[model samples]
Target: MTSSDLWDAETAERYDESSAFMFAPDVLDPAVDFLADLAGDGAALELAIGTGRVAIPLAARGVAVIGIELSQPMADQLRRKRSDIPVVVGDMASTAVPGTFSLVYLVWNGLGNLRTQSEQVACFRNAARHLAPGGRFVIELWVPGIRRFPPGQEAVPFHVGAHHVGFDTYDMTTQQGTSHHYRRHPDGSVTYGASNFRYVWPAECDLMAQLAGLELERRVADWTGEPFTTDSESHVSVWRRPEPPSRPLEAPAGA
Candidate 1:
């Protein structure tokens, strides 16, 4: 029930360590490349940009990447790595940094971080407000509905490490799920923990963007621009902001 539990300083510090390599670019570089191409000649705004995982590389590529994070610890952590990229310590829903950006990105299902329908909508609105003319908002989120087709189906196995494994289970009604991580430590100790939440679908996300005045430009099964099909479990959605108005508005007849 607490947004701080998922985000904030303590969680931010432990996030990268616990979920290290979860968003491996080797499996995602093609998507990043596609995003980079859309990022021509302009700065980028990254939401929930924990620990600078993607922003660092993006900044290194000569792209100006600014990050907005709720956790000061995460922003501080990113600062420790590199001071080149600017990070604003605040929530993505309400935080406003001056000036517009050419590209804005939220990865790793970061949209789910809001944990509420209204909050998610606010995120879309805020993203639109920050975009420059002809800017784009790029997101990577799960496609949902794949986990439950026949009904009452739960429990999907996730292999983390050779010895460390996990199980993710979902509630058919609530659409919530728990990811349990079981790690066998070298000292004969086993670590067990769980995180739960609802999953949002790609179609719902597209609608969210459309309501925010952004248009879906492309949606790919992966970062490589692969066509999305029924078999694809996840997606990379790209949305472009409405282009500038064609001409200046004429004034009504003077009083």
Candidate 2:
């Protein structure tokens, strides 16, 4: 993971407030429900957990949840909410926590934060490493929106609101993109923020999972389980680690 991608103290401090819409019941509840159902009496691990936005509610539902976050400030913000959830501070691609889990998840396009194909692949392997046999690894990611780009256009606007304007600029050759945000304050001052990520295709993610010894289980347009059609803008995909092969029965008393 790139250290430059880490959310700093300022970003962490304003994270929840800046992205408040994501915490609404309409957006958050379905995600918690989906993950809790997958966990099903087993522990769940979150990659790039970031401020406990999902982990807090998911944990409230009686599912054991642990987290790995690359940003210490983000982890600190999460700790402020609830002290019980264990959050390891390190890169999600290679961080190792003790014990295995029934479910491992990376939500809100966190995989893109890795910024490199190899790092993203390593993240899949890391998720597989922390899963118990037959455990599931899940990711929620945006489908690259290059189709909206006309000739010679490298940027597309995603949000144009009363107080904020946001756009993403893509580099087709490198599969990298940067999301730029301009927020207008009550005083008419504007603040600018940007984050960089490498966009990945759904097929590429499946190949990474395969390389990590996991099998594709399902893919949906969102946490609500909408069927993933060609026009879907984002996806929530699941891949499961195969259970260990059973040993052959031994002859009774070595007869």
Extract clashing residue pairs from model 2: none
What digit string (tens of lDDT, one per residue) describes model 2 on residues 1-255?
A: 353397899999999988988899999999999999999999999999999999999999999999999999999999999999999999999999999999999999999998889899999999999999999999999999999999988689988999899999998899889999999888999999999999999999999999999999999999999999999999999999999999999889959
Top candidate on TM-score is: 2
Please name the candidate that would achieve the greatest lDDT relative to the true structure: 2
lDDT (C-alpha, whole model) for all candidates: 0.80, 0.95
State the weakest 10-residue window (summed lDDT) of model 1.
Answer: 1-10
Q: What is candidate 1's lDDT per residue for 111-204, written digit by digit as tens?
A: 8667667778888999999999899999888766454445555667755575578877766576566667887766878878776655788888
Give per-model TM-scores: 0.87, 0.97
Instruction: Tell me the spans in candidate 2 whose CA falls farther than 4 Å from its real position.
Output: 1-4, 253-255
Model 2, residue 212: displacement in angstroms?
Answer: 0.3
Quick one: how many clashes does candidate 2 have?
Answer: 0
Model 1 clashing residue pairs (backbone): 31-223
